[model samples]
Structure formats: structure tokens, C-alpha cells
Target: MRLPKLLLFIVLFCFVFLSGAQIQAQETNEKADAKQAEPPSSVKELKPVTTIDPLVPLDQLRIMVRPLTKDELQVEANAWFELLRNKSRQIAAARLGVKKTNEAIATNDDQQALDSLKKAESVQHMADEKARQTEEELTKQAQETLGVDVAVDAARPDPAKAEEGTTASTEEKSATTADSTSTPDNPTTTQSAEAMKAAFLQNINRLQDERTALSDRLEVVLTSLAAKGGDVETYRKYIAAVSGLELDTSDASAAWSGIKGWFVSKEGGQRMGWNLGKFLLILFLTWVVARIGSTVISWLLERKVRLTQLAENLISGTIRNVIYLVGFAVALTALEVDMTPVLAAIGATGLVVGLALQGTLSNFASGLMILINRPFDVGDVVTAGGVTGTVKQMNLVSTNFRTFDNQTIHVPNNSIWNGVITNITANKVRRVDLEFCIGYSDDFEQAEQIIRDVLADQELVLREPEAVVVTHALADSSVNIVCRPWAKTTDWWAVKTAVTREVKRRFDQAGISIPFPQQDIHVYSTDASKGNGKIETVSK
Candidate 1:
């Protein structure tokens, strides 16, 4: 046993020495390769085309001072795309390295496996740096050739040049119309316009081609990365540059070096652990405080402040929710989650949601208005937004009401706010105004007295206001009487209904006539024998 242990120790020491030597040799070779493959000076060259000379004739300028050719732009774009391909290639190589590392581990070659992973990471880093420099080259080329920060196809044409073209065309048309014998036309202008159009189209096509190629390569790399999803150096090779090609990195969980990295990385492991501990402590504290805060709020509302149940619930719930959100934000920051981008994203998302849901936003605003104004409370019988119903539940977006038929109706707050709101039970007392028609011959005074008696006799009617019955109008067939009485708001409907029934009964009992609708037609006929007209009455 002593001899075997001694041999194992010697073997381990030799393996460690060999691995260090191998790593140092690999690094030297990589540096040499990097130095040899340095990018050409032309790649970094820039000749910024500041402002276009609108006065220069397109054809003349083509023959005179030299300008950058379209091929140069294509070469620059190709260079940039080549860098993208190389990046994908690096990731692919790293993936192979990961496989080799795994194989080494399965074969009990631990040092080889660790070395492989380290090499892969180093290669990925070098590749990323190269890609970054290449991106700079791409941007510089765009600035020099396009004379702007963005690509050529995205830039608008010069307004001055457009105006010049229009002016030239007008002059040409004027010349042709004035004289037919003049030089038919100069084809140079047509050539110039066509050339410009062709150039613009060519640039657009080239940009699209480059973008498509980059997108395809990015897709392939991403797909491979997804398939090889695990805690390996290969998976994270192209992680940082995924956004440029518009690939979503949210699902790149395995590339986070497993769950521990979801919070913080191993390089900052101690600090991360401390922060995580604090985060949990803060969360626990927040939860305890939130419960206490909610209880205190409810107690204040019920005992000290005095508010309705709904109002208290709304206030306490809102306060607790706000505290919860603030606590979560603090915890997230402690966990090393970037809050600035999170906040910006939230703001931008809010703007988009607001624009998309304009009607909904209006409803929310109106609900706030309704809450503040207190026009009508829940259970109030009201005519709102063209619907008459008893308000059941009033919320932020909509108000639910129960119609007379017991059917539920939901009204948007915006409509209710914009339209008229008539709360039937708004006042403590309400007046019931009713008009009754009596026949011309029957006895108007008696009918008025009967109406007053009916109103006064009603149980729900308020005696303090005193009921009034007056002759309103005397029509061709009847005398109209107005009966107005006051009652408690809750019993107004019942009193009005009862008064109507009682008035008709008392009038009939008192032999006072309530006339039905009638019309009298007069007919005139010519009598041939007497040669005179005779008139007769026809009642309807």
C-alpha cells in the first residue's frame, strides 16, 4: 500500500507539471497566430464624406474628382460578415472542445478536461475581442461611405438634389413645348437619374444580403448552442453577441453556468453569497413589514380614519402592493439584477401598452375620476351611459350593474364619465310629479281635490313638503291636473305608483270623469233638393 501511494503521488505531480507546460505552450502559439493574422490597415481606414455637394452636376462629378466606388462598400460589408462567420466558427470549435473535455473526464483524464474548458473560454474571449474590433470597422466604413452613423439604404436622399432634379425636368419640358426644332433632349440627365437610382438599389440589395447572411449564420450558431445546452464553455461562446442578430437569450439558462449563476457568477462567488443572504433577509423583513403595515392600515381605516369597507380594502391593498413592489425591487438590486435597464424597459413597455390600449386607458382614467368625484356609490339606482340599472360593483375599468330584468350589464367608465350620470337615489328626498286628465264637463275642482287626498293619504309620502294639486291645462276635451308630492328617496317609487292607482279609484268613486282620448269630426253635405249645405257632428 505504501509503494502504491508513493507511485500515485509521483504520477499526479508529473501530470500537473505537464498540464501547466501544455497550457503555456498553447498560449504562446495562440499569441503568435494572433500576431500573424492581424487585420489589414485598410480595414481601419476612414475618409468621412461630410456633406454632399448638391450644386455639383452628377455626370460632371463622375468624370471629374474621384469618389468612393460601390465595390469598396461591398468589400467593407463582406469583411464585417466574414467576422460574423468567424465568430460562429469559433463557437463551433469551442463546442468540439467541450465534447473533448467531456470525453477526457469520462476516461478519468481530469487535468485534460479542465485544461480543455479553460482553453475554450480563452478562445471565446479572444474571438469576442476580435468581433468587437470588427464591429468597429463595420461602423467606421458606414460612417465614411454613407456620411452618416447608419447604413446607406436607411438614409434619406438629399432634398437639394431632389429639388434640382424636379427643376431640371420642368425646364426640359418647357423647352420641348416652346420649340420642336431644339435639340430633342440631353439623355445625360436621364442617365444620371438612372445611375443614382441603380446605385441606391444596389446598396440596398447589398445591405439586405449581408443582413440575411448574418441572420442565417446567427440562427445556425444559436440552434447549435441550444442543442448543446449545458454547463459548458461551448454554450457561452457566442452568448454576449446574440442580441445584434436579434436572437433571444432569455432561454440561455444552461449557459448561465447552472442555477448559481442566475444570481451571480463564481468569480464574485463570496460577494454574491453575501448579497444573496442580504436579499433573502430583506425579503423576509419586507414580508413581515408588509403584513404589519397592512394590519396597521386596516386598523387606521376602521378605527382612526373611518372609511367604508370598499374604500378601506382598496387603500390597504394598494399600500401593501406598493410596499411589496418596492421590497422586490430592492431585493433584485441586491441580487445584482440591473435596475436601470429594467426600469427603462418598463417605461417603454408602458408607453407601448398605453398606445395599444387607448380605450382601456381612458376607462382607467375615468374610473379614477369616478372614485374621486363620488357621483354614485355601489347599490345606487342610476341611469348611466344610456343604461338604467342598480350599480352592483364599481371597479377601475368598468362598473357592473344589475338591470331591472336582473340581467348584468357592464359599462365602461369612460362612457359613464363622458355621458350623463343620473343617480335616482342621490338625494335624501325626492318629489313625484304626475299629471292626470279630467273630462271638460266632469268637475275639475273635485278631480284636483281627489288627487290631493290620494297623495296625502299615501303612507310613503312626506307630509312636511305638503302635496300640491293644481289645474294645469284645459284642452278641447278635458281639464289637465298636476299632482306633485314628496317622499323619502327610498320609497319615492312606491309612493308614486300607489298615488297613481288611488287617484283613479277615488275619481271613479266620486263620480268624477277621467276622459279617454277622443276627437270630434264635423261633416258637411250638399242637399240637391234644397240647394243648401247641411252640417252634422261625428264623435270619435
Candidate 2:
């Protein structure tokens, strides 16, 4: 009995000991999990935590009060919003972290609870901060777009929302009340739920008044500057800068300075010579590249591309322009030169020139259309603009023409495009037409046969289309016959001239008298007193 009892007691002791060990193992795992947990990469985790806020790049930055295009103003607004959002996040995270740290100590280093609370707290903080910043940005952008001080919806922070996050220990709650009196950077004047809203409204109103006064003054100053010439516009911009606006002050002076700055302002003028050398090198390279690109484009068009001559030329010209423009832009940027003013000047000059040469520009446009449409090309005999001439050269603005009288005429493209164009030499083959007249008494068949024989004998005339001599009409004294022959365009005139000469000669040899204008007349003589007249027909 004693042995059985001892065995049973040992079994019970082992079971209790194993169960306690299992419980201790579970507790250790829970502690490990708590320690392993960590916060995510938040806005605070960014580098250089204590440095000044990241402002927008100088090239992109614009004054808050300045006039800007829609796209530009949007970029500016987005930049400010980014900066503000980042700044607000960092502050909120820090404040919440402090609240968590003090609460963790109050809970006697309850690490597992603290970690869960931290995760919830940080997420909530980020969301709230984002919503707040977005509201502010929207309000500011609205006012800017309206170009006036529009009403802004106030940003009111709810205390219940901020403090309603994770539950804290009793000790943590007491501390929260004392710490919540302080804001992110400024202490709250009042403990109301809308304290933030009140403060923000007050600040915005002050800013609105200041900006309005400056804008009003600026308008008046600009009006005065418009009347006073000679760099008064430049002065106006500088004044705008003083009034907290960014006006583009890039003028001739700025342009020159920018150019000079490229060469002389690098490394305390250490690379002055090198910079100048680079400028010259870039120019030389640009010329070489432009020539090479032009040659390559021309070769491609000649061999591989199946476009028309005019299209080929246009493509080649455009490619070369691009090469030069790009190469120069790169070189200029390397030297730190700004081309804004130069480009502006060019645009302004072009506008003036275009307005002055309206007719010429019209001709140019019409000429381009003609070239594209290909109504007629060089060496074609075309009747255009009420003048018939052979095209000598077809230029972009006009067509050079050589008239039959050996006079050169330049017909503007406008006149030709608007007129009917007849291309006489467009066909490879042409018809030579000739007419002959013979006495009505002459055998019409014989006369026709004689003309056909003349045309058949002409070597320059074509035989496939066939030559024909047909009696055309019976006139008062003659039978009009037409002799038609076909010939190559180059041989048309020669064939016609030869056929005409031969026909006349053959008719004479055959005794077929060519008609001369003659009439058979009748003369009647009678004594009036006799009241009788004898009529006689006379041939004259």
C-alpha cells in the first residue's frame, strides 16, 4: 500500500511541475513578441530631422501673390502642400510619441500594450494630419485662383478626436490633461474644441489684409510705370519683389548677366577659361553635327524613303533645325545661360515682321500648298494667272516662268493657286491640226486624198493613231478640209509645219487650185423710160 501511494504522489508532482513550465514558456514568448514589434518608417524617419523645411526648388518656386498660369500655379500650390504636409506629420508623430512614452511608464513598462497603442496612435495621427493639411491647401488655392481674399473654411481640431485614441493608464490620463494644454508649437489660448479654428482664422485675416494692400499699391505703381519708359518696367518688377511677389525680372540686363555667369561664376572663377572653351567647343560641335545630320537625312530620303522631293526637303530641313536647336540649348544650359529673354525677343520680332509682310506670307502659304498639291512642276508649259509660260523654277514663294516672248515673269503663288491652271505639255503625245481650202469645183475626194498623202509622207507624225483628211464644210467658194496627224510632243510643231507646206505643193502640182475669194456677178442695163429691163448675169 505504501509503495502504491508513493508512486501516485510522484506522478502528481511531475504533472504539476510540467504544467508550470509550460505556462512560463508561454509568458516568455509574449514578452519576446512585444519587444520585437517596432514602428514603421514614419515622416520623422526622414534624414536631417532638425534642418529647416524643404522649400521648393528656385526654378519652380513662385510668389504666393504673383500671377501665374494655371499649370504653374498648380505646381506651386502642390509644392507648398507637400512641405506643409510633411512638416505637420513630423510634429504630430512626435507629440503622440511623447504621449505614448509617458503612458508606457505609467503602465509599468507594459511593452505589449504600448506597441499596439503606438501602431494605432501613429496611424490615426497621420490620417488626421493629412486631412488637416489638405483642407488648408484647398482653401489657399481657392483664394489664389479667385485673385481675391475668398473665405477659407477653418481647421478646427477636436479634442475628443485627438484624445479618443488608445486607452491609457490612469496615471497617463492625468499627464495628458496637463500636456494637452500645449500645442504642436504654440500653446492654446483657450481650451475649447475649436481653439485651432479660432487661431487659424485670426492669422489668415491678418495675412489677407497685408496682401490686399500690397496688391493695390502694385496695381497703381504698374500703371505709372507703363507711362514712364526706360527700365521703369524693370523697376516695377523689383518693386513687386519687395512687395513679396515674384515677377520675372529677366530682361536684357539679366540675360547678359546670365550668359556671363555661366563662364565666370563656376568655382570662384576657377574654371573660367574651361567654361569659355566648353562654349566654343559646343558651338563647333553643333555646326559639325548639323552638317552631318543634314547629309544623313538627305541620303536616307534619296535612297530609302519614297516621299516626294518637296516632302523630303521639308523633313531634312526640320531635322537640321532640331539638331541645331537642341545642341545650342544644351550648350547654353551648361554655361548657365537663360534663353528666356532671347526667345521672347525673337517671338516679338517675328510677330511684327509677319504683320508687315502679310501679302508675302500669303504667297508663301499658297506656294507651299501648290508644292504639296503638285499642280505643275518645272519645265512644264502651263497657263496660269492669265499668262502662258514654261515653268523655269518653282520656288516656295513664287514660280519663275519664261513666256513665249523670251520674257521672264515671277507669278506669285496666290495668283496661280486661285486661277485655273492648264498644263499644255502634260501629255507625252499630241495632235497636229491643219486646215486647207480648195475651190468648190475641185474634186473634194481628190483634195482630201492629196492632204492625206502629205501627212503620211511626214516622218515626224505617228501612224498608230492614224492620220486623216476629211472635208470639214462647204463655204461660199471653197471646200474646207481638216488634216489631223498625231506626233510626239517634241515633234508636234515640226510635223504640222511640214504637213502644211507639202499639202499646198501637192495640190498645186495636181492642178487643185487653192481657193481665192472671188465672185460671179451679173450686170443689167436698160433705158428707164422704156419701163422694161433686160437682165444679164456676168461672171467677173
Candidate 3:
């Protein structure tokens, strides 16, 4: 009985211990689950409000603004103004966050402060990205509503002006507030597009003023924070991010007024007039110098160099044009005009023009080659570019040809250069080749002698080289003779015609017949009754 009681007590003690351990394990699991469910204290504490309050999200604002009618744009402009105000607040909040984080770090020397600083920086980065996106969308909207140039000009902030003011002047503040109040609440209200654009521009100006003020405030805060041994680098980066949001407004009328005032002012007008006079004087001097230089070059080329007319003209004209260009550039410099952009533009234009005129350039290059190599010149008879003609004119792009029939042809220099060039009158003398045919029965020796006699009788034919008369070929009907005579290039045609006529006359007198083409045909007929075939031959 004592042993049973002891066993029962042991079992009860073991069961109680096991149940207690189980309960403790359950409580530990619940605690782990609760810890996992909650976000880190640092992350929760530093989560930035990413939205611009009292205005739709940037994406929603884009949708709302995109399809708005011209009259409706004014109403939306108010919302945009409100959006800008909220953005200014957001920037202020971010600035405050940085100050607070810095203050906390200064006061607390612990890991928690470091973690908070890191989280705060992360949050600030996120805020900056959102602000950038919002600014871009607003800029795009403005650009779409107004002309791109006008919007860009209006939005382009003047750094000098921005640096001058930390806060808007009382008058400027009142004007901005007044402009914001002028925007109509009703979307159905009729308003001119111009008026709406003016209002939008006014809002953009307000936004710029607010941003300048914020930047000034941030500058002070950053300076103070830096004095307190806080992280100023992060604040500086924030300032830079905000500075990128340029949304200033400039009045066209004010710009025009200023320009008019400058022109009307005696000192300004006189200075401008003086510059103009200087530019004109420089240009005139340049023109006079260019003229004198060109004349000198022409005289030198003609007298000293004694180049061909084309080469002389090309050189003189090129020098004259270069002089003119240099003079123009000098004139511009005298006027204090920037030449960098001009030169860049000219270089770009030259590249495009060169690409477009590749064939013309090729012709020009070929023409230069022709001039340098002296292949053919004006008045020379040439067989080139598949055309036989006298070269009437030559230029960089093309060569003019006058055919024997008196038809003028314009041949590209490239075409003439790329092919075989036969300059008939390039040399002082040329050879005239003539072929004559005689009957097969006629004596070949007699025909050859006749051709030689004809060539000798022609006064224009050259004798030093001696003429050639030989049996060239024997055809079925005739014997062919080749007569080659050398003569002055100028008298070549006359010599050829005279020799040919004399040879024909001599052949006719000597009874050497120039036979026509002949053929012999044979026909066969079969006699059926006799079983024989009769063959007949006919000559034609």
C-alpha cells in the first residue's frame, strides 16, 4: 500500500512538471509571434508622409489635370497652387526631421540614435524622390498648357535673384496671395486660355518664392545643425534636391519693357550704335583687303605661275572666298559676337552637306585630278565617258562637250575620270586609220600601192613617221587593205578625207573592183520516174 501511494505521488509530480513546461513553451511562442508581427521602432518612428496633403496624389493630379478643358484649367490651377503650398510644407517637414534627428544624435550617445538617424535619412530620400516626380509632372503639365519655350523660360529660375531673397517681399507676398484668390472655384466658368495661363504662371511664381524661402530656412537650420556637430552633408543633399525644382515665373511684358528702356537709353543706344559702326567698318576694311588680295593673286598666277585659265580661276576664287569668310568672322568678333556656336553650327552643316553631296564631291575630286594630271583641256577633242566631242568648258562638277554634230553634252567629271580617256588632240599629231576592200581576184599589192600613193599626195599627212599600207585581211569576196597616216591633229580630218577620196579614185581607174558580199547556192531535185536526182548550181 505504501509503494502504490509513492508511485501515484511520483506520477502526479511528473505530470505537473510536464504541464508547466508545456505552458511556458506556449507563452514563449506567443511572444515570438507578437515580436515578428510588429515593425521595428526606428522604422515606425521615421516613416515619412509621402503625399502632398489637401491635394490629390501626383498620379491622380496628372489624370485630373490632363483632360481638363481650357476653362477648367483655371480651377485646376488653384489645386496646383494648393499642391505647391503642401509641397512647401513637406519640404519644411523634411527639414524639421533632419534637425530633429541631428538634435537627437547630439543629445543621445547610443545605438538607438544612430538607427534613428539612418532611418530618418532613408525617409528623407524617399520624400525627395516623391518631390522630384511631382515637380516633373507639374513641369510637363505647364509645358503642355503653354508653349514649350515660354513655359521653360518662365520656369527657369534666376540663381542671382534666388540668392538675394530668403523671404518674399510684402508686396510680392500680397500679389501671390491675390493671384491665388483670383482663380475661380467653378469649372464651368468661362475664361480665356491666356488668362488661365497667366494664373498658372502666377502660381508657379508663388511656388518658386516659397521654395526660395524654404531653401533659406533650410540653410539656417543646416548651419545651426552643423554648429551642433550634426550631419550637414545629408541636409546639403536635400537642399540640392529641392534646388533642382525650378518653377519660377518671368513676365514677358516686363522683359520687353526692360529691353525697350535699354534701347531708348542714350548710353545703351550709343554703345550699341558704336558697336554696329565698328562692325560695318571692319566688314568694309575686310572687303577692300580681300579685293586687293584677290587681284594680287590673280596677277601673280597669270604672270609668274602662268597656270591654265581653269587652275588660275580656281585658285584666285578660292582665295577670294576665304578672305571674305575671314573678314566676316572678324566683323562678328568686332561686334563681340560669340563665334564658338557659329563655328560649331558651320561644322555640323558642312558634315551634312558633304554627306548629301557625295557624288558632287567625287566629281570635284576627279576634276581636281584632271586639272593636276592635265588629261584633257578646253578645245581638245576627246573620246571619254562614252562621248566623242570637243571639250568646250570644264569645271569642278562637270565638263561640257560639243559633239561633231554640234550637240552640247554635260558630262560629270567623275564619269570622265573613271573611264578610259582618248584625247584625240592631246598630242600635236594623230594617226588616221582607213580600211579598203577589193575583189578576191584583184591584186592586193596594187591596192596597197594605191593607198600609199594617196597618203603621200595628201599635204597635211606627216612624212617623218612614214605611212602604213598593208593587206590587213582576206574575206570571201574581197582582199582588205589598211592605210594608216600620221598628220597634225588639226589637219587629221582633212588628211583622212583627202586620202580616202584619192584612194577610191585610184582603185576605180586601176580596175581593182571592190566586190560586194557574194554567195553560191546549190539545189537538188529528184526525178521519181527515172529514180535519179538532178543538181543545179546558182551564183549571186
Candidate 4:
């Protein structure tokens, strides 16, 4: 050993000396070349060294073919580096082309959005035009049936003797109509004229009342539009549209006064009129009631004596949601809004989505069932759908579990309901099972006593059921000893771990052998071992 060590140190010293000489020779040569170099005016030609052999395998041979100079090696390294850089640039250019194609595809998406916007605008314009035409036809029919033109002509008498002729003519016509009514079977033309005149008079009065109400409503609408800084023509159409509504007001004077001042007042008022105002008020009241109702429900749930955490969550989420939905429906009806269109839209959307996600809907329905039934709560250790873990959270489609090994798993609710659920922590008490084998040469009683002692040492091990040690099986080489101890569910792991450690440690100290499978072989020498039994040629 000493000789080998000395030889290694000698070889290392020679290598260091040769390397140092090479470095010194190179440095001297560089200094001499620098001293002989002329002034910077002349350009020096750079000639690349041609050849340098790469490192060869060390096991081949100890002798080297003339080693290349440093300049030659540097030239070769530069040439190989340039080739690699060129290859990398080519690869980068290919990647850039792919990126440009992706940019073009993204730009094409804007055209789709623009097309949708244009379609929506066109639909809105068409609906507006159709509503306008329908309102105009209704107004025209009401005007033609009411005899409004005849009523207006009758209201004004001739310029000369207007008051005297109006009173006398009205009395004479009434008297004539009353006499003609006595002979009902033979009604004359004058009677018919009087009847027609009375019918026209009643119809004219009704039309005048409708026109007055419409005028007041129009004024209110015009005031609102003007306040909003709408264009003159926009205000005119708004007034005309409202006039067609034929709104009836009890106090015309008060209504017009309210409308005129509403435009000047700081407070926004009668410009919206009673219809819109009542609608907004109903909506606000509904929201407030819903909020208060939700708060009261939360209070009630909190006050309950046997309220579970899950029930509390359900009351706030599910029950409160139902209340809000009903409240909104009631508010919409109170405002006299047509809910049919909205309902139809909602039904169509639901139909499409339900058809698309049949599996997801099934899981959601199963999840609701699980929540209502509550087979297991959070932190319950369960094995379901081929997975074992503690329940972390329950969602609409799936349940999340955090396994003992710290892996997060998502189990579908449908699978949980369809598969077997083994809840280990459902019971308060659990039994620990243990088994060990001892060599046949070891005393059975000693092994049993050791296992019992190990069980007794663990404080978490329960004493009520008592620990048991039995000779479960007898094998060819060993006797199997089975030990059982009862413990609380929470203390199962602690007792199990403590007993296992103590059993191993005490067994080693007591010289008790834990047996494992082994094989034995017998060898016979041809010359020696055959003398005892081979005299009769008997081999067992």
C-alpha cells in the first residue's frame, strides 16, 4: 500500500511540472511576438489553423499522435459553435411562422362579434316600426267610430243669434224626439234624426273626455323628454305616442300643474307619471322585503337548538333563494309587466343546456339528494367509488376529499350514491388487529406473554374488552401468534403504532425470533457418507 501511494504522488508531481513548463513556454513566445510586431498602420493577416484531433478514448493507447496547438483547437471550437448557432436560428424562424399564423386566426374573431351586433340592431329597429304602425291604426279606428267631427261642428252655432238659436233649437228637438218616442211602431225620419243626434252627442262626449286625458299625458311625456335634453322631434313623437294611450286622470288641473313644475324642480317627479313611479316603488319594496326576510331566516336558523351546520347553510342558500324568486315574480306582476316572454326565453335556454349536459344534470340531482339525506358530514372518513378519504366539501356535481396521504380527489356525486360507502369513523369504537410469527424452536408461552405485555404498555389500548393473544396457525417452521386490542376510534392509530414498536423492541431483547420462509439443503460426499447407508444401496 505504501509503495502504491508513493508512486501516485510521483506521477502527480511530474504531470504538474510538465503542465507548468508548457504554460511558461507559451507566455515567453507571446512576449517575443509582441516585441517584434510593427506599428498599427499595417493590417495583420489572420490565418486559421487547419487541424486538431478531438480527444480519443483513454483505454485505446498510452502513446499520442502529435498534439495540436491551442490556436488550432480554438479555430475548430469556433467553427462548430457557428454551425450550432445557425441551426438554432433556423428553428427559431420556424417557431415565429407558427406564431404569426395564430395571430391571424385571433384577428378573424372580431368579425364574428361585429356581425352579431349588426343583427341585434336590425331586430330592435324592426320591432319599433311594427309597434308604431299598430298604434296608428287603433287611433284611426277610434276616431272614425266616435263621430268627433260632427260633435265639434255642433258645439259651434251660427255667428248671428248663436245663443238664442242654440237654446231654442235644443229644446224643440228634445220635445219632438219625446213625442215621436210615444209612437214606437211608426218612427218617422225626424225621430230617427233625433235618435241619431242623441247617439252622436253621447259618443262626442266620450271622445272629448278621452282626448283631454290624452292631451294631459302627452304634456307630461313632452316635459320628461325635454328635461332629458332629447331632440325636438324625439319629444314630439314621445308626446304623440303617449297621446294614443288615452290615459284618464281625475284632476286635470292638478295633473297639468304637477307636470309643468316637474321639469323645473330639482326632484324628478310626475314626469315619470304614476305608472312608472309605482313600478319602481314596487321593485324597491320587493328587494327590501327579500333582504329583510333573508336576515330573519338567518336569525331563526341561528336560534334553533338542534340546527346542524349543513341545515344552516341550506336555509340561507336554498330556502332564501326560493323566497327571493317568489318575491321577484310578485313584484313583476304588481308592476303589470308581461312575464310570458321572459319565461319563454328562460325555458328555451334551460332546454338547450339540459340536453347538452345530461350527465352533469344527473350528478347535480344526485348531489341534492346527498345534501338532503346527509349520509356523511365533513371530516367523516369514508371509502366510496374505490377511493378512501375524509370528506372535505360537498358541491353540486361532486364531493371533494382530502385523503390521509394528502392528495386531493374529486368524487362525482352520482358515483358516490351508486357505489358502496364504507364509513370507518361512523362508529365510536374500533378494534386493532395484529399478527406475528415466531420460530418453532421458541417457546409459545413466552411469545404470547411478550405480545400481551406489549399491548399492556400502550395507554391508548382499552382494558374493557381485554387484549387477546392466540396461536392462530402452526406452520412448518413457525407458530403464528395473533394479537388483538380494542381502542377508541380516535386512539386507534396511536395504540397500534405504540404496540407495534414495543413488540419489535422487546422481542429482540428477549431473543424471540420472528420467522420468515427459508430453505435447507443436505449435501453428501460420494466417498465418505455412502459407507453408513450404501452397504445395502439404500438412499432415503
Identify the candidate with maximal lDDT: 3
CA lDDT, every model vs. true structure: 0.61, 0.58, 0.62, 0.55
- TM for every model, in the order presented, reads 0.46, 0.43, 0.44, 0.43
Better of 2 and 3 by TM-score: 3
Top-TM-score candidate index: 1
Candidate 4 accuracy as TM-score:
0.43
Residue 204 Cα positional deviation in candidate 3, in Å, after optimal superposition: 36
Model 2 off-target regions past 4 Å? 1-342, 349-352, 516-527, 532-540
Ranking by lDDT: 3, 1, 2, 4
lDDT of 4 by residue, 1-540 (tens): 999999999999999999999999999999989876752432232222211111112222112212423332233223223322332232233223223223322333433322332332233223333433333333333345343422224554321233234224534544454454444334342333333333323222322332333333333333333334433354344334433212125434323433443443322233334546676676787677767876777778778644545445555666657766776776675554547559879888998988999999999888888777767777789998788999877767888898999999999989998888888887888999988889988888998998988787778889989878899898866789899999999998888888888988988999999877764545544456555532223223
Worst 10 residues of 3 by lDDT: 47-56
Global CA lDDT of candidate 3, please?
Answer: 0.62
- For candidate 1, what's the RMSD? 32.9
Q: Over the stretch 1-540, how does candidate 1's per-residue lDDT look in tens digits?
A: 999999999999999999999999999999999977875567445432312221223344333223334333334224434555554544443334334334433443334433443453344345445644555565565466765664234364532233234334433532432343233353433333233323222222222233334544333333333334312233224434432222114324223332333234322355568889999998998898888999999999889877655466667867888899999999998885647568878988998888999999899899888877778876788999989999887667888899999999999999999999999988899999899988888888778777877876778988888878899798877889988899999888898889989888888898888788899999999999999999999999
Prediction RMSDs, each to the true structure: 32.9, 25.4, 21.4, 39.9
Error of 1 at 435 (Å): 1.9
Residue pairs with backbone overlap in model 1: none
